[model samples]
Target: MINPNLALKVLDSPFHHTVIHNFLDLDQASLSLEALAEQEFIPTESDLFSYSASNNLSISDNPDIKSLYDSLCSKAWIRKLESLFDVSLSGNVDMAAYVYMNGDFLLPHDDELDSRLLAYSLHLTPNMTLSDGGSFDFFSSNTEGEAKEIVKQVVPKFNSIVIFKVTPESWHQVSEILSDVQRFSLTGWYHG
Candidate 1:
């Protein structure tokens, strides 16, 4: 469930992004995230990014993780997000668990894709800090439309969620992880 106040904050952002803390039931979400982290992760690598990602997690065997995924796609949840962002979510959500270890990073890019209306990341990292260098950095374009410096950086924190409207100017990246600890999160896109 989303708070109306938080939704308003997201709607009022420069590029329309809102960060929500305690996004889910803390105890239940934590347990599920821990279970999801134990599963096998396939290596996702490219010139633009490097990280480990799981297959579509909606079919997860872990009950808690499955529930979390289900809620994100549920009609009720869709209504909540739609009410806030003014986007018509198709009630179809694609999501997966991701792991970023030291040196893992994603370069800046707009998450432009067919059917995608919003991009989201729910941080499950238990004890990460800014010093860890794995923050979700948001960018704004310059006059000529080139990607500019990061305007906002979100340090991954347990039970926190970041929702960004996926548009041409919505460029963002995951900064390199400097710590040895693994950075964990559930990320996905909601379709229109």
Candidate 2:
């Protein structure tokens, strides 16, 4: 990790989230991208999302990928997450790399899976801009806890990681990619 001692800002309105910039050093980030690029990605599409994704990174045989996955599952990493989120983590994490090409998108939805306490995305795509159109957008909820309109647009800056607490109101989505550039990132959840 580049910034091992991370300083996080918690936002409570739209949803609880923290964006950590410079999450990994350039060398490590490049290596991670290389490893992930070699892995096969399967086309995945549903009513809510469309993209290509790798299998669970925990099962990867590549040393570089395994090291990264192990680091995330490490005690130090869990401690930092627990401290920052103010929640007890079960030390189990599921991770996979995703590539969203032109026209790819994910609709708004709260990550309320069983035992999922937090969801995260680590951006690895360099030179991605606002014009790229693949941003992590957070949505405000109605009084009934249904997702309404987008309240926050988080550009997926290279080497940045976005973490958010999983709740019924924690609705977010990846805006459609209008550009031809591929939006690549590693995403997953931390179990309670």
Candidate 3:
């Protein structure tokens, strides 16, 4: 379990701040889950659908995957998010593990779930090169148009967890993965 104070610090950091942690054996987990996804799962439009071209694997219904998701949600990290945002989440909050292969990407867009109030993702691949182009880009905008300046660019790394407010203003996307190796991560949203 993560410390609540630490989670608060992560939330209160500057917009789009990137923090790295290496406590979990996410690389091994990623490999195991990736194999499971490849052999036992079927891809759907909801799983792969993004503003840009990308391949995604949804495992919300899998018992093993759901156990992991439940653990994450019960951690102090999630409790801190609730305390910071003053929101209570409920219902069946699902999760998806995305595997971005070479040339796959997700275009800039806000998560559009009415029940969701926060979004979280944990990178599971090891030694991911920043130049591989799977970095997350965050944006800000006004009534005029897309904001000229980029808020931040977060490099995806193993065991790195990113939690953020989810709204129409929180625009973000995963750039195209340029490497042959798959870029894997667990992604989900908190619902109310």
User: lDDT at 175 for candidate 2?
Assistant: 98
Residue 143: error of model 2 in Å? 0.8
Clashing pairs in 3: none
TM-score per candidate, in order? 0.92, 0.96, 0.73
> What are the lDDT figures for the candidates, one per model?
0.84, 0.89, 0.61
Q: What tens digits encode model 2's per-residue C-alpha lDDT throughout 61-140?
A: 99888877887888988887798788999988999999999999999999899999999999999899989999999999
Q: Which stretches in model 1 have alpha-carbon errors above 4 Å?
A: 1-8, 11-13
TM-score for model 3? 0.73
User: In model 3, what lDDT does residue 14 have?
Assistant: 27
CA deviation > 4 Å runs, candidate 2: none
Q: Residue 34 of model 2: what lDDT? A: 89
Model 1 reaches what TM-score against the true structure?
0.92
Give the TM-score ranking, best first: 2, 1, 3
lDDT tens string, model 3, 21-114?
A: 6434554455435544453333333443432222333444555555565566674545655776666766345566677777777777777578
Query: Cα RMSD to native, each candidate?
Result: 2.0, 1.1, 4.5
**RMSD, candidate 2, Å:** 1.1
Q: Write the per-residue lDDT of candidate 1 for residues 1-192, one digit (tens) a residue.
A: 333344335654348888888787767666867787678999889999999998878787777777777778878778877977889988788888899999999999888899999999999888889999899998878887657988889998988899988888888899999989898898999999
Measured by lDDT, the strongest candidate is 2
